[model samples]
Target: MERKWTFLTSHLTSLNASTRPLNGQTAIVTGASRGIGAAIAVGLARAGAHVVVNYRQNAEMAESVAAICRRHDVRVLTVQADVSNAADVSRLVETTSAHFGAPSILVNNAGVAHTGLLLDMTEEEWDSIMTANLKAPFLCTKAVLPHMIARQYGRIINLSSIWGLAGGSCEVAYSASKGGVIALTKALAKEMGLSGITVNAVAPGAIQTDMLGHLSDEDLAMLAEETPVGRLGTAEDVANAVQFLALPSSSFVTGQVLSPNGGYIT
Candidate 1:
């Protein structure tokens, strides 16, 4: 017997609705100027959450994303801060708090990707990726935990990578940092459990974003063909995972790695 499946892209539904499940909540997304971060920001907005779009630079792009989110009628604010720095992170949280009360959801999606030999990588480069990918989540999570604990409810979804699950060649630093994210999610999930906060990680695999710009068409085709889904995943695909984690309905699913990798690594 042969079985086949069809995915209807055109049939996808919008995340926005006045009565959507996230109504009255607020979400903060880092690295949201473009790429997966942008998609997640809008998706959270569509679900009726007042959103904070956080970007280090690229104000123009961040504002553009904010404009789109505004169409959903949710309160949207664009904040510029380098998530890897502690002082900047504090200010970012404070600014969000001033405008939206307190963030109920935090998406730690700001990260850089590196590819090179471990020996060839400079110490600065290694530290840069680690700070952005791993430490920022630590700081962001720590900053938001107090309020979430006080309210006894929070959703923290960290953006990890499939490379974190299966190491990548020529991407040693990136892989190591994402793996640390997984560790952070697990440990924090345990720590925040009784406090009514859930910490989880979303590891997208070979998503079709600017991150794949370095790949040639042929290379991308090969990568897509290698996946069981026969295609590269979209930024929206990853956002779907984040959305699920952000929902109040997902309260029981904590300390988990939800990888939307098209079954490439599985």
Candidate 2:
């Protein structure tokens, strides 16, 4: 007999009270203007962490996410910076520190995806994808690590993908970049463990985000049917996982990749 899959909502009752688990902490979420990044920002705010919503080109959308976070009664700030650039990463970290002190949590959610056959991909395209999806994490983590190490406490969560674990056809660049993210998480976790910092990754599968806009109705329906849960994942599904990993109590967990894929790849 085939086993049935349970939706994430079915496990909601197992969660603890809505009380703040991250009070007085500050978190920085990169590329938080929309989609999964935006969801993670709001989720962190609701948990009582001051949030710095980082965006590269969409100021309006970044502010919109900030407004949602503000409604949670937690402090919210919006910053614009190209995470892949060293100077910009420095500016982002400095501004956050000036306003909210050094961040206790850094969510490297900023990333770009490209879907195409390797034969058709250009060098510029591959470079851009790698810089955004992989280099940004390295730069941001470097900028934040000093503060975290000094404080002896921090949470660094990288947004990875199912493709990182299992390669995707026609998405070679994207797969390789996310795979680098997973590798970075593991190495950094070990390096930072002695300093009381935990590093981890959240890999989402076929989420209902703007990223799926390119897919046709039939394509989406086919993907849903393929998933054992009979549905696609959600930004909130990934957000919930980030929230858990960000908690102070999760100190024992490190170098882990939590995939909210709805049984799509497991």
Candidate 3:
């Protein structure tokens, strides 16, 4: 008998119109043209938040994600900006504010990964990874923080990796960057808690995204076997965690690191 497979997007229906938790809010999801970022944008829109889909280079892909968000009957805006650049981040934030309003939710989902021996990695390569994975979050948070603080409300979610918790063998730089994200999430959570803003990080295990394109079929199978859930994670799995963190009821849950790794490292 053929086994049926469950997808991440399939869980969206579980949160219907009656349960729209983010009504009247605006959310910004960086690197949202594809994969985990796109899924989060859709999830937030489904929860009734106007979504700003921020992408670096792919306008067409961003438009596609925006179309999906529009289906949820929430406002959708697509902005092209490199999250790591301060000026670009400023423009992205200002555009969101002007078009929608101060974004109450920010998802720092833009990141880059490098796989190689630490010794073989060049300074430029390491910097690129750090800038995208670590610095981008810092820049985006700084841009949106003032508004959140002024309003005494906000939710910020950073995308971390399982490697950040348990360092990977060949992905030293990526691991370091994500670990920094986790630390930033915790420290910022403490700092922002008094202002009614919550900060959290979602660390996803191996997921079916372009990030895994470098892996072979055998490698993927081996990873699945290592996971207790008997399968790789999905973008939607991570998105669900992000949605929970973005909800107003979760205001009390701050500075937490939620990993959707399917028990891969716990």
Worst 10 residues of 3 by lDDT: 1-10
TM-score, per-candidate, Cα-based: 0.93, 0.93, 0.93
TM-score of 2: 0.93
Mind giving the per-residue lDDT tens digits that candidate 2 earns over 151-212? 99999999999999999999999999999999999999999989999999999999999988
lDDT of 1 by residue, 13-36 (tens): 223332487988999999999999
Candidates' lDDT values, in order? 0.93, 0.95, 0.94
Query: Model 3, 1-266: lDDT tens per residue?
Result: 12323443445544543488898899999999999999999999989999999999999999999999999899999999999999999999999999999999999999988899999999999999999999999999999999999999999999999999999999999999999999999999999989999999999999989999999999999999999999999999999999999998898999889999989998
| Whole-structure CA lDDT of model 3 | 0.94
| Residue pair clashes in candidate 1 | 15-46
Measure candidate 1: CA RMSD.
8.2
In model 3, how many backbone clashes occur? 0
User: What are the root-mean-square deviations of the candidates from the true structure over C-alphas?
Assistant: 8.2, 8.6, 8.2
Stretches off by above 4 angstroms in model 1 are: 1-19
Query: How far off is residue 8 in model 2, in Å?
Result: 34
- Candidate 2's displacement at residue 96, Å, is 0.3
